[model samples]
Structures are given as C-alpha cells and as structure tokens.
Target: MARPKNQEQRRQALIAAALDSAGSKGLRSLSLADVAKRAGLTRGAVLYYYEDLDALLVEAHKAGIQRFCDRRDTLVQSLDSPGDQLAAAIRAGLPSGPDDALMRLLYEFDVLAGQSAVHDELVEAMYTRQLAIYTSVLEAGTASGDFAPVLDIETLAMNLVALEDAYGLHIVAGNSHITVDKAEQAMRAASTGLGAPPTPDGGETPPA
Candidate 1:
C-alpha cells in the first residue's frame, strides 16, 4: 500500500489530478471518478478532500488561476522598481509554453458556465476572482507610475489580458505571430507611450 498523505498533500494531489483530467477531457465530460482514478486514490478519498464534484472543480479552477497569480504576487512583492515590477506582471501573464492546458480548462468552464445551471456559480466565481486580481495589479501599477498615467487601469488591464488570450490562441493554432519577448517589448512601449519625453542619458538607474 502507498504511504498515506497529509491533508494538504492529499488536497494538492486531488487538485492536480482534476486539472490534468480537465486538461485532457475538458470540463464538459469530466467526472469525479476519473479524477480519483488519475490521482491513484479511491472516490471516497477524493470526496474526503472535496465536499462534492462541483467543489472539486472549484478547487481545480482555483489551483489553475493560483499558478499565474502566485507568480504575479511573487514578482510584485520582490521588486522595488516600478518599471521592473510592471515588466514582471507582463511576463507573468504570458503563456509559459504552447500547451496552455490549464488555460483551456478555464476556457472550457467559461463556455459551459452559462449553459449549465449546476456549474454556473463555480465558473462565475472563477472569472470574478481572476478579473479582480488582474484589475488590482493594473491599478497598483498605475498608482506607482509603472504604467502610463493616461490609460484607464480597468480597461487597460482587461485589454492586456485579452491580448494575452489572443496570442495564446495563436500559439494553439500553430501560428506564432508574436513571441513572448516581442509581446513584452510591445507592451512596454505601449505602456511608456511615444509621447512620454525621452529620458536623458543616465536618467534611469538599474535596480540595486
């Protein structure tokens, strides 16, 4: 028999299994049984961690979003320089690779959210939390002068996220129009804007 896991470990294992299953089969046909089998645990074991299947799905969604948001929090917390911090946010939002299975699961939830009365609440909560976090980061950037002063924080944040989503689709379709590096440069330029006065040589200092 396998060694027993602690509460946190069991919870994490369930979440990871759910995410993997959702990524492979999407939320449309996902089942608690499948997740339990994938995690190498009994269905009852999965239930011990999650109250129900919907609860399990919610935890999976939380885990997926937490991956990106945790990186954002780390980058934001570590930087004293606003420029570098904003850059870090942009980087964090970028797709780490072409797979984007977690993103696909979230998208699947979104598409099915309105149709399924059973899943709507969990789906809506996921969207609300993700949007709120992105908006908060954008507003904080503006307040710190990490972003252009004129852009509306809420709109800009949404647009930036939209752009990332679009680019991610491009990658999924096997046509990479913009590299992550190019996206970063374009975003930085747009954030800085052409109208901003050129900083005189030696005006900007490196992060200490």
Candidate 2:
C-alpha cells in the first residue's frame, strides 16, 4: 500500500495540482476533478483539504502571488544600481510567455474582478502589493541620487504596474508578436519617461 500524506503535504499537493490544472486547462475550465486527477488523488481527498472549488482557487491565486513577489525580491537583491533594479523589477514582473501558468491564472482572476467580491478583494490587494514593490525601488533610487529627483514616485509606480498588467494580458492572450523582449522594451521606455538613467545596454536610456 502507498504511504499516506500528512495534512500539510496533502494541502500542498492539492494546491500544486490546482496550478497544474489551471496551467493546462485554463483557469476558467479548472474543476475539482481535474485538480484531483493531476494530483493523483481522488475527489474526496481534494475535498478533505479544500471545502470547495472556490477555496482551492483562492489558495492557488495566493500561491502565485507569493511566488512572483519572492522572485522579484530575490532578483532585486543581487543588483546594486537603481536603474538596474528598476529594469530587473520590470523583467521579473512580466510573464515568461503565453505558457506561463502563474501569469495566466492571475489574469484569469483579473477578468472575473467585478463578479466576485472575494476576487475583487484579492485583485485589489495584489495591485497594492505590486505598486509597493515599484514604489520602494523608485524611492530608493531617488534618495540615492541614482534617479532624477523631478519625478513623481507614486504616479510612476502606478503607471509601471498598469503597464505590466496590460502587457501581461496581451502576452497571455497569445499575441504572437508580443514577446517578453518587446514587453520589456516597452517597460524600459516607460521607465526612461519617468527620468531614470540609461542602463548600460542601448535599450534603457533615461528621459532627459
């Protein structure tokens, strides 16, 4: 007989399975049975962890947010320059490609924003968190004299987040011409518009 999973293990397994299903089948089509099948568990086993499909969806969304935030934080820590930091943040925030499950799931929740109160709250909180990340980096750059002092940090931060949201949606929607490279270039242009200094590469020239 196979060994039984502990409570935490089982919960994590189900969450992983949920993301797998969302990635492969798209979040709109994700079902409890699909998650159970991905996890190699029965539907009853899935219920033991999550009360319903909504509960699992919420958990899965939270997991994706945590993963994205963690990755951006780690990437920022390795770089010293503010321009580099800003560039890194933009690159990190974007989806890897159309096949990126985490970004796809995030945008899926975004599409359902007004219909579900729970989803609306999650989306709001996510926006706040993302904006804060940009604000922190921009503030640090300004204080360190690396970025232009004339810029409005809050507005720029909000714009960056908005750009990411729009471009991410386009990428997830499978625009064949809209690759990650193009998205990053657009973000870099926005960053320069905000008076950030040019990066070493020819691509990241700050606005005068």
Candidate 3:
C-alpha cells in the first residue's frame, strides 16, 4: 500500500501548487479549484487545509517569505566577518530558480496591497522586516571594522535592498537580458561605492 502523506507534506504540496499556478498567471485569476487540480488533490482537500482563497494566499506568501529567509540564513551561517555575511545575504536575496516564482508572487502581493488598507500595512511591515535584516548585517560589519568606519551603513543597506528589488523586475521582464552574475558584480561595485574596498583577491568578488 502507498504511504499516506503527512500534514507538513500536504501543506508543502499545496504551497507549491499555488505558487506554480499563480506565478504563471496573475493571482487575480487564481482559484482554489485551479490549485487543487494542479496539486492533484480534490477541492475539498484543498479547502480542508485552507479555509478560503484569501487564507491560502496569505499562507502562500508566508511560506515564500519563510523559504527565502531559510535560504538566506543557510548562506550566511558560520561566516567569519560581517562584511562577507552581508555580501552573502545580498546575493541570497536575489531571485534564484524557484525563488523567482516566489518573487513573482510578491509582485502580485504588491498589486493587491495597493487596493486594500490591510494588505498595504502588511506589505509595509514585510518591507521593514527585510530592511532590518539587511541593515543589521551592515551595522555588524561596521562595528567589527570589517567595513570602513566612515561608511553610511543604513543608506547603503537601503540602497542595496532597492537595487535587488529592481534587479528582480528586470529579470522577470526578460531573463535572457539579466544574469545573477551581473547583478552580483553590480552589487559588489555598489558595496565598494560606500568607501569599502573590495577584498584582496581581485576586485570583482567579495573575499570568501
């Protein structure tokens, strides 16, 4: 007999299916039945996990954020210097593979957020959380002397966050035109723009 799926597995399956369906088409067009069909489960099963479309969407957005955060944490773990950690985290924020789809979902949220006051507040909170995460790393680097003392860490952090957001938009416009390698190079240059010198080994990559 086949093994029955666990609750966590089902949740993950639903999240994946929802993202897949919503990412390709705008969330405005997404329906529970669409996600159910994509996930290979009945609508009743989907509704059992998510009471309604709004509930499912909120859960999907949270899952996407959590997934991105997990990836960011894994990439920055056990790093010696704060500068390296900040650079690594910047790279982590970029849309990669499935992460691209998640980001597309975020863009959808941004649209919906414009229409509803509640969503606007939620998006603002999410934005602040992201800025705090990036800025904290920069402040740590400054404190440790890994980055120059004169650097404006807060301004730079915010700029990097904005840059990454724009870069994702460019990629979504046409993946063929934008490459992560180029984005990394641009980020490295931007990092150095704030009076922080590039690592000793060549000028492009931040020292590992």
Candidate 4:
C-alpha cells in the first residue's frame, strides 16, 4: 500500500512538474528531460511511472483539464442561483494570477501543439469541457428565470469560454493590464451585457 501510494504521489509530482515546465519551455519544446529535472527525478524514474514522454504528457493534459474545467463545473453546480453560478464560474475560470503555471500551460497547449496530434486532441477535449461549463450554467440560469439571454445560449456559452481563454492567456502572459480581478470584472460585465447578469447576491467572491 505504501509503495502504491508513493507511486501515485510521484506521478502527480511529475504532472505538476510538466505543467510548470510547459510554462517555461512551451509545449512544443517540452521534453522528458525538462520534466524530470523539474521534478528532481531521474529520467529512468519518470519512465518507471509512465510508458514514455507522450504518456506522461497525456496524463499532464488530463490533470490540467480536471483542475481548470472539472473543478469549475463542480463549483458552478454547488451554487443554487444562476447569477451566483455564473459569477462563481467566471471567478473560478480565470488564472489565479500572472504566475498561474497551470492556466499558462493550458493556453500553450492550444498554441504550441506543433506536430503532436495528441496535443491537439487534448486541447480540443479541454475546450469542449470549457464550453460545456458555460452552457450548462447559462441554461440553468435561463430555466430558472435568471437570464434573458440576448444572444442564443450556445453562442453566449462559446463567447464566455472564449473570454475566459483570452483573458487567461493575457493574465498568464503577465499582461500587467489584465489582472485576475480586472478579468473577472470584465467577464461579469460581459455577462450582464449579454443578458445573464448575476442577481444582487450572486456577484460575491467565489470559493477559492
């Protein structure tokens, strides 16, 4: 049991190292050696856990999706009001800040796939999940009479996901102008403009 638990911990460590490395190395140039060095483990040790670099990358991409998308979906579902759900979704979706390596890696995955169709597929999967979060939340808002969407819900959902991705890219790129707070505020404004304003109580700070 101890050995298996240790292995799972090491695998998570490698995934984290890969995300951090991608922020510096970029996905196109990320290599097994970089992840090994970042994790403070030998190449052979990494190999012991993953079949190869691609295997490790696939796992890393999965972790990114879980953190960025799955967690946001859970957060949205926990809220009872559509306004609060949308607000929390907006809050949870952006980068924590300029040094948010996970969000940075997620943006890079889309831009730096190079020749790896695997990377492309992973990025697509993340987008689908991202879009779905907004879709479900907005639909609930409409159903609950919280939103009178100006645009179709599908388009609105796509736009919200696009806004999240664009703002997140800028934030992780260290755009001094696009702070997380500013991004969230802008998104909330956009949501209201698009006809999904959170109610008076829903605009509060989301759970960390």
Candidate 5:
C-alpha cells in the first residue's frame, strides 16, 4: 500500500539522518531531536518509524555494517589473486578517516555493547560478520597457495579485526597522524607477516 511505501521511505530517511548526526556529533551524543532535525522531520514522525532512540540506533548500526560489507564485496569482486583480495579487504574495512560516520557509529555501538541484551547481540553479530570476511579470504589464499599454510585462520582473522578496530578508533578520536594510508600500510605489513606475498610497490594497489 501507499502507506507502507511511505513508511519505508521515511524509515530509510531517518536512518540516513541518524548516521549523519552520529558522524558529526558521535553516537554518544546522538538524540532523537538531532536525527529528526537532520531528516527534516518532527520527533513524532521519527517515533512513528522507530519505537525509540535505541531502536533507531540498532537499525542504524545494522545499516552501517551492511554498507561496509557491500563496499568490501564490491572492491574484491574483480580481483583474482587472494593476496590482492586480502589487501583490498583490509583497505575496505578501515574507515576513510576520523570523519567516517559509519565507522564512528560502529564504535559507538561497540562501547555500548554490554549495556543491554540488544546492544550485546548486535555487537557480537557485527564482529562475527567481520571476522567471517577475513576468515574467508585467508582460507581462500591458503587454498590457492597464495598465502602460507595458516594453521589457525580464526586467530589470524581475529587479529586483523582487532587491529582494524583499534586503528579506526584512534583515527576517529582525532589522531591526525594516524591517517587511513598509514593504517592500510600497517595492515599490509601485518598481512605479509602472516605469510601473504609482499608487494614490491609497498602494497599500494589501485584504489578500491
């Protein structure tokens, strides 16, 4: 029906607004009014789409994760080499910089994970999904003899995800020296240590 379509559209708008507000102000300070203002809608209208701030945040966090996953998928889709795929995944996983709204939102949810069951579940699911991406890449690389025979794929994946989380938080927290390029370089070095092929050009591949 027309009403359902309108509702869905409004819902998406609110989510987009929430992401924008979170990007600028950080999720810790995000409010219904901020989201409503960003969406050019009233608070009541936002409430009509989402039950409350927490509900809206949960959905927004999921949307952010989906966006990141889609980007990584697109970046590696045409790459044939597993080493290249792993490198692309690393670059795609990190935020552009501290100004990255989606990454900011992700960390915001991470800080709140233990506060409630919903938050904990969402955080766990997001982490699991991220780890899965790395695991797949590592396994594929090993299978194709592009990567060393990694005895523990899960541990390697966890390490990469953890490194990404730490680096992303530092960048978002205004570590001006810790640029995205530096983060990617560090990740590439770590990947090489894990038995990936070393790039002669310092792992600088075409932009994903």
Candidate 6:
C-alpha cells in the first residue's frame, strides 16, 4: 500500500498512466489492465488508488483541463497587451500534433459526454472555460482601446473558441488538410478580421 504521504503522487502517476494508455487504446476501449501495464503496476495496485477506470479517467480529465486552461490563462495574464494575450492564448490552446495524447483525451471526453453525468459536466465546463478565455481577452482589449472589433465581443469570442476547437480537432485527428501553423495563422487572421488583431509584433492593425 502506498503511504499516506505518497498517495497524491501515486494518484498523479496513475492519472498520467491512464492518459498514456487511453491515448493509444482510446477512451471507450481503455481498461484497468491497460493503465496498469503502462504504469508497470498490477491491476489491484491501480484499484487501490481508484474505484474504477471511470473514476481514474474523471480525475485525468480534470487534470488535463487544469493544465490546458490554467496554463493558457496564466500565460495570457502574464502578457501586458491584450493583443499579446489573445495571440498567446490561441497558440497555447492547440495540440502539438496527432501524438498529443492530452489533446486526444480531451476530444475523447467529448465522445464520453453521454456515457455519464460527470462526463457531461466536464465537457460543458471545459467549453465554458474555453469561451471565457476569449471573452475576457476581447473585453479587455475593447475597454483598453487596443481592439476595434468588428463583431460584438460575445460573438467574436464565440467564433474564436469555435475555430480553436475545430482546428484542434483536425490537428489531433492527423488531417493532412491542415497543420498547426496553418491553424494558428488562420485563427489569428480570423481574429484580426473579426476586429481583434493581435498587435504585439506579428499582428496587423485592423483596417481603418
């Protein structure tokens, strides 16, 4: 048995193992044995930490959300300009590639939404958090006179989140149709044309 002091570490390790295992096998097909194999522990050892695979995955999903949204928001807040914040937020929200297990699991969570009430809540919470990022940035830019958005702040924020989710889906799905750079460029372009061009360095000022 893991000592009380190591319980949190053990749980975090299992969460990582579960994400890795499910990354390849997928959420619907994942099993406790799969996680155990990835973690090099017995199924019983895994059960010691989690009631079941679903319980473990619920925590894994929350961890993934925390890492994704929290890091992005923190980075956004670190930047002084709303343009820099918006640009940084968009870039931070994407997958590294098809092999990005974390992003893959996030999409899987969407598929699992109907399987349980907890999943439904996580999915909705993720969407809300994503929307809030853009909304907050856009509102700040508008208030500071940094952005002269073409659309209402709410509409613009919704469109940006939609683009990120859509492009991120394709990027993780391994579509040759779009690469990360293309997605980022397209999103930044959409942002610029929509009235919120990132004005830090690479961003163009919106049309007069």
Residue ranges of candidate 4 with Cα displaced over 4 Å: 1-10, 23-30, 200-202, 205-208
lDDT of 2 by residue, 52-129 (tens): 998998888888788788888888777777777888888888999998888888888788789789888889888988
Give the C-alpha miss distance for residue 160 in model 6, angstroms. 0.8
Winner by lDDT between candidate 6 and candidate 2: 6
TM-score, cand. 4: 0.85
Model 2's alpha-carbon lDDT is: 0.83
Candidate 4 lDDT, 1-208, residue by residue in tens: 3398888899899999988888788887888999999999899888999989879878888898888787888888887878888888888889899877788777766764655878778888988988888898899889988899999999999999899989988999899999998898888889899999865433554465
For 1-208, candidate 3 gives per-residue lDDT tens digits of: 2235687688888988887889877798999999999999999998888898777777777777667776776666656667567667767777763347777788668777877676776677667766877777777767777677355777777787888778866665556767776776687688777755334322224434
Candidate 6 lDDT, 48-108, residue by residue in tens: 8899988999999998998889988888888887888888888888888888988988998
| Alpha-carbon local distance difference test for all models | 0.66, 0.83, 0.73, 0.85, 0.81, 0.88
Name the candidate, 1 or 4, with the larger TM-score value.
Answer: 4
Q: Which stretches of candidate 2 lie over 4 Å from their true place?
A: 1-5, 202-208
Residue 152 CA displacement from its true place in model 3, Å: 3.1
Best by lDDT: 6
lDDT of 5 at 29: 78
Rank by lDDT (best first): 6, 4, 2, 5, 3, 1
Cα-based lDDT at residue 149, candidate 3: 36
Among residues 3 or more apart in sequence or in different chains, the pairs in candidate 1 whose N, CA or C atoms overlap within 3 Å are none
Query: Candidate 3 clashing pairs?
Result: none
Evaluate candidate 6 by giving its C-alpha RMSD to the native, one decimal: 2.8
**Model 3 stretches with alpha carbons more than 4 Å out:** 1-9, 97-99, 149-151, 175-177, 197-208
Candidate 1 segments exceeding 4 Å error: 1-8, 47-52, 116-147, 194-208
Instruction: Provide backbone clash counts, one per model.
Output: 0, 0, 0, 0, 0, 0
TM-score, model 5 to reference? 0.90
> Clashing pairs in model 4?
none
